[model samples]
Target: MIYDLIVLLRQNPTAEVCHKSIQFLFVMNVIALAAVQAMLILRVWYLFSDQKWIQYSMILCFVACNVLSLYFTIMASQNLKLLNGTIFDLGKHGCRASRPPNFYRMFMPSLGLHTMLYALTAIRALRNRQIFSHAPVLKRLIRDGGLFFFVVFATVTFTAVGSFLTQLPRINITVIYSNYLLSLTSIAMSRIMFSIHSLASNLGSSTEWLLSNVELSRVGWRKGRNENEIIVERRCAGPDDEDYYYDDHSVLDIGGGRDDDIELAHVDGVKVRRSYDTSRSKSPMPRLTESRVGVYDDLTW
Candidate 1:
């Protein structure tokens, strides 16, 4: 902005200086846009659990957009010329693009990419409506991605239209605004990533208690003083004959529970059977499980 002000304040600024500034701005915009797209691709990849087809499709879109952007950028650069005017000029003093009326077309690919990402997120959200409806992270992912896409899509669309209409003034303003939008997108994505990580951590911690306590209690077992043990007793069996025995170091394994070692328990007066595997890993952090719990159960954690 200071550089812009300086250029505007200068009288009879050299054409070379103006060209360099334009080139620099164009390069910065391209890099920023690419970075924003990369982040969006990553977000989508995570949203889909890194599905190969989805990742490849996003990559193809990125490549296509960059290729088209490159072609249009080269054409614009080749046709770029300096002019003396306050209407379409980069500066009020003496800096403006004299040619390349279709320069705004270069940004159309970016707009399209943003739209594609937005659609992907929306579709994913809709398809996984049951999952996202209950999951705050998924909902926020869609919300943030949509908001970012909307802002960028709107700006790029307006800029593209302005370029088509040869509204150089609008194009000039939007060029600057495009960079601002890129920054905003980057910040929004970063926040979403942070939010997801935090939510995952919290969910892991909270679920560990359920996995150990509630699940064990259903079997008439109480958590022992040590984290690695639980005391079990049969409800119908007499105390003297009942086996108070359980693995002393039976660490709860949260990952796909052992299918064969199913234990039946009376949970809330309803019989329920669940599988649990013992963990040997030293790390205490709970693992994400793939097993599905019964309908009456809170979760198969």
Candidate 2:
């Protein structure tokens, strides 16, 4: 579409063609910028998943940004004009747009939106700074989100500031700045998403990262007898890991005593228990429930 727009403008050089090109650029640029903001906002949304206010606030800002973008799209379309009130000279290779003094208003929404997103990401990172060591994925997310915000913020700022400058010495530096902005926006967004996609694909092997965010219920994981004299055996591996208690004969007595009621720890040190009554068949009523004296309440994370 960009290439075609350029070609059409150059070939025809008509007033209608220039007008439509501006409209098209405005619409496409708004969509691209909005998509970038949405992704950045979602990063904050996920980080503060339990905070209702944060989520609602981000949603409101996102909606406001879109509405402003729509309003400004119209404003820019009507306001911006072709440079020197003329078409692209075939000899010059391309056309240049002549923007109004207040043309920067069209990009104000993006600057404001990125600022808010960056602030939110910063505050959240500060609040959870202590957990970064334990949660590498979360740390990387915050880092990447901040970088994305800065890239967008700088893009918008440069475009807005460029509106104030004009042609110098027969060369317009800010000419076709909008096209440059679009290209940068698309490239940055794509690269970030590509990195995230690669990380997500390897999530299965990253159990520690998963455990850091996962909410495991202690009572829910207790498998067997409810009233067993449970022993807390903490290992830094889940049941699926080789280091789990299943392999150790001392934990499960096949040759002797069978009072094994153990609580296994999660990879992040949260405990979830499972018990087995091996000598249930030896009793007359079978399935004897062993109760732990003085410890009735379940442990919390």
The top-ranked prediction according to lDDT is 1
Task: Please list the residue runs of candidate 1 whose C-alpha ends up more than 4 Å from where it truly belongs after superposition.
Answer: 1-12, 84-94, 167-301
Deviation of model 2 at 111, angstroms? 0.8
Please, what are the lDDT tens digits per residue for candidate 2 over residues 1-301? 6554574457435566666766776677778778877777767777787789979988898888788877867776786676524554434434456654445566677778778877888888889998775554577678887787688778777775665455541222452343677677778788777766654444322323233334221211211122222222334333432233221111111111234455342322323343555463665432422222222234322
TM-score of 1: 0.59
lDDT value, residue 32 of candidate 2: 74
lDDT for model 2: 0.57
Q: Which stretches of candidate 2 lie over 4 Å from their true place?
A: 1-10, 83-97, 166-176, 205-301
Please provide TM-scores, in order, for all candidate models, with all chains considered together: 0.59, 0.62
